[model samples]
Target: MSIKKEILKTIGDLLMEKLKNLPDGLPDLMWFDKQMGQFVPPETDDTAGGTPEAGISLPLPAVLMEYEPFAWQTTGGNTQKGSGNLKFTIYCEHLADSFPGSPVRDLALQHFDFVAAVHQVLQGLQIENVMSPLTRVLDEEDLAPDGVVFSVISYNTTIFDHSTSRTRNHVMVTNPGLEVKYKEESSRPVPAVEIPAFLT
Candidate 1:
């Protein structure tokens, strides 16, 4: 598999392993967070205010690309230069037990653990390896306006940023939580992913 797919696959598998005991399987091979809860509105519409329905289940968050161009320089008479793209993707998810949402500190811990594990795996590889869990952002303040705070960035520049000199690249591993502003996958029923009843 290409580095992109390989990295994603590793993360998806590891997440499932962490919550291996949870039922309701993932739809295909997706990175899932089963322990977390979904966000909900405080007020409801009814004769009076009614209780909100159950929280929405979520899919494995995707790390969208954040691209940057590498600068190059030449010592020729014309002083030529070149540019290459440095691509990044950050994936994250957050939970809301109450109005504001789940505590940020708790999720930060998960982020750290995930990062450490991923880093270890990446460093141990022989061939050019892919990082797992992506890169995590620990600060609640770093979140996007919508609410996503924590994130993991898994990226490869080899394809976009080719080099003639010796390639020097480092792996950055992570898995930080992020708040969700978008809607859930409620309309399309979550597929039946059955686990052994005995485990449940």
Candidate 2:
């Protein structure tokens, strides 16, 4: 896989792992698809190649709102650096005691709990050869009629690109006073040259 893709996958995988570790645990939500290499939401029943039951349950707890990436300017080097946003829409359910026309303290607290959990898990997250993670809470809103509260949190992670060229080059350097050896089947030329004093 390309460096960019790998980096994105690493970030998604980490989130999935953290969610899995949650006490109540995460359901089968369409957070990220490894095969698609993007944040694709689960399809609704009305959509092609999708079952109605799935779409009904989807967008359940968490949905990735955006996975926007941008290039980063570094001091100087061949390595490429970048940053991306992973925005999530977390759904919180109203409490059993919560009633209509009254303050939804239960729902509010539940939403905050989910936000805190995500924040604790994502901060300072590290992947090999990549910068540690940084995250912030964007905002929250209550979706009426459905009785579901939504909160948005954006996670920022550093990306490093070390992609290399596909072409291959063979180099042979012969030092002074060293004899070049070749196999019987080899037809490659052997070029002799003087060796630097420091190298010798």
Candidate 3:
């Protein structure tokens, strides 16, 4: 598979494995595909003062959002290996449980714990022999319309830069000759024979 596809596949699989056992009867693992514009979370109308349905079965609390390839550089002259920066976003809702008035410290702790869990899952992650150390970018909090908090993490991972090496392989074939070796018991001596230019 291509480097980008491989990287994403590895991350998606890893995250699913780590977060498979979330408590609170949260929704199953969900993915937000940027190209497809799918997997919008429930309670999205909350920002518009519309209360989410009380008993509606919404999608999972955790979602894998879009990833951006920010920067890339060649590790050496070879195109086989390089490094690049990939920013990934993960959104989760119900960060804290509210009382009659407001949320308690447990909410904050839950959010912190989720972030720590994701960090632990991504640290020193390897995909297809490429190593990545996931680092969080301390950007301003991005709350979705449904009140889901989004976290941006940067993955600076090694990539296999695929490039056609036609320029390196093309060479001028000028002279072609065949070298022959004979044993001592051979009856005939080795002779030089002219080879066709096209054979070069």
Candidate 4:
């Protein structure tokens, strides 16, 4: 798999393991696909009923994740590095109650708690093979007409791609040999002079 996909999978797995057992219940985790719209719920038997509107009948307390396209720069040789943002959109139905301190009010505002949990789990998180730890960069909320609240949280991280890099291996030499030699003295005018002086 490509680095992008691997990163997404790692994030999803981490979230799943960390957030699976919440006070409310297990949330539906999904990947955001632009072609399929912002949210796509699990497949159900639609034969009994007509096709539901896109994102209308989505399961409550859903977390949708997607990674934005990043611009890559060649670090060296065939290795490239890219810094990008990963977003998680939390969806929950707004269940308001006019009564003060009602349990329903807590349910209505549960998305905030969920958002905090997600942020706590992801902020400063470092994944294997990623160049940097995840840092939260954005947190915003949007309300839809259908009473579904959207909490979008974004994180920034850097990832490196070494798929096209060349593999290099070095061999070690355990034993080495060495040799040394001395040259004989050049022809000897000094030796002939000494012999003539001795004879004299």
Candidate 5:
């Protein structure tokens, strides 16, 4: 296999292995979300003359690019802060069901603390030169409910020049989707309601 393919395979293997170690239900749910209507095959039809059949139909534009976390040290000069930065991605259909109300999306963020280990192992779990995975998601601008496609990205910080602060930002530049979630959201306070003093 090509070098890139091999590396990607290795990462995938690690992700699967790490996912296996997750608390049972969590991993299953992730898998379920990933598997939902995600593939589209080429169009074909019954043919006798070896000629074209009917009109062409567009396939669903959906995909899932998941990565297992990994880290490698200063292997050498050519490597230069190599592997200091890591990245993970997820591509899928961003259906109306896959947003805030979707448990899978919510749970994925929740499990990052545990699932993150999959990548940390690359650096022996030291976490000295690591950054949170960059996570970027893409979908339709107007965002239709049924067939909108989406993607997710998570990036690890890089330790360039041996300094920790100059890290690569996660969610590498891109226009985000209509929906977003923050880890600190749960900690945010709800707006207070005011009642007429006379009603009291």
Candidate 6:
């Protein structure tokens, strides 16, 4: 697989493994796309299934991952180095009823817990073919329709491209022999040096 795909899959697997056992239950993980039709919540079966859903479906929460275009520069012969940002968007339904007596009070601000857990799993993470450990570069939150709250978190890392590198074949010479001839003895070339024996 391509390096980009491998890196993304690795990240997703790590997050899935780490976040699967949270008290609130595991959240769905998906790759982000420009067309978000697939992310829309499915229609409810009520009213003969004609009514569209007001909000996205849950696992209560979900995460979408994507990466920014890489900025690249030639590092040396046939190799280029690049830096880019990887972003994760976490979506959750906002719960305003976290009053002291509410039974679901623990879930009122549960998105923060998910954010923290994501950071813990990803911060300083190192992956093969990547030059630097992942580091958080930005974090922001926004409100969506139907009480959905989403947080976008970004991390920066460096990677290298070696696709342009050429394969080279090398030959090794061992115990080479040398010949020498004196000016007066031009007719005869005598063995004057043997590499390993001469050095000894």
Q: What are the lDDT scores of the predictions, listed in order?
A: 0.36, 0.54, 0.54, 0.67, 0.36, 0.67
lDDT of residue 90 for candidate 5: 31
TM-score of 3: 0.54
* Collision pairs in model 3: 96-107
lDDT of 4 by residue, 10-110 (tens): 77777767876666753534323222343433475443322223347556666677777777887766688898887777766665652577867765666
Best by TM-score: 4
lDDT by residue for model 6 (1-200), tens: 56677777777778777776666653544333222333444453343212123455544466677777889897666677789988877766675666799887777667778778778888999876655799999998774444666777889999766766443223455655756655674666777985675654
What C-alpha RMSD separates each model from the true structure? 31.3, 11.9, 12.0, 9.7, 28.0, 11.2
Q: Please, what is the TM-score per model?
A: 0.29, 0.52, 0.54, 0.65, 0.29, 0.64
Q: Model 4 misses residue 89 by how many Å?
A: 0.8
lDDT agreement of model 6 with the native: 0.67
Candidate 1's TM-score: 0.29
Cα lDDT tens digits for candidate 5, 1-200: 33334444555555555555445443321321232223332243222212211221322221234333445465333333434333342322333343576767654344343334433443332232323333223222222233423333444443323332224222366676657866664767888998768754
Poorest lDDT segment (10 consecutive residues) of candidate 1: 132-141
What order do candidates take by TM-score, descending? 4, 6, 3, 2, 5, 1
lDDT of 1: 0.36
lDDT per residue, candidate 3, 113-172, as tens digits?
A: 565566677766765545455544443345444445556566565666545334544567
Model 2 residue 21 lDDT?
Answer: 46
Flag the better candidate by lDDT, 3 or 5.
3
Q: Tell me which of candidates 3 and 5 scores higher on TM-score.
A: 3
Which ranges of candidate 1 are over 4 A from the true structure? Answer: 1-58, 65-67, 71-87, 96-108, 121-141, 144-147, 152-200
The better-scoring model by TM-score among 2 and 5 is 2
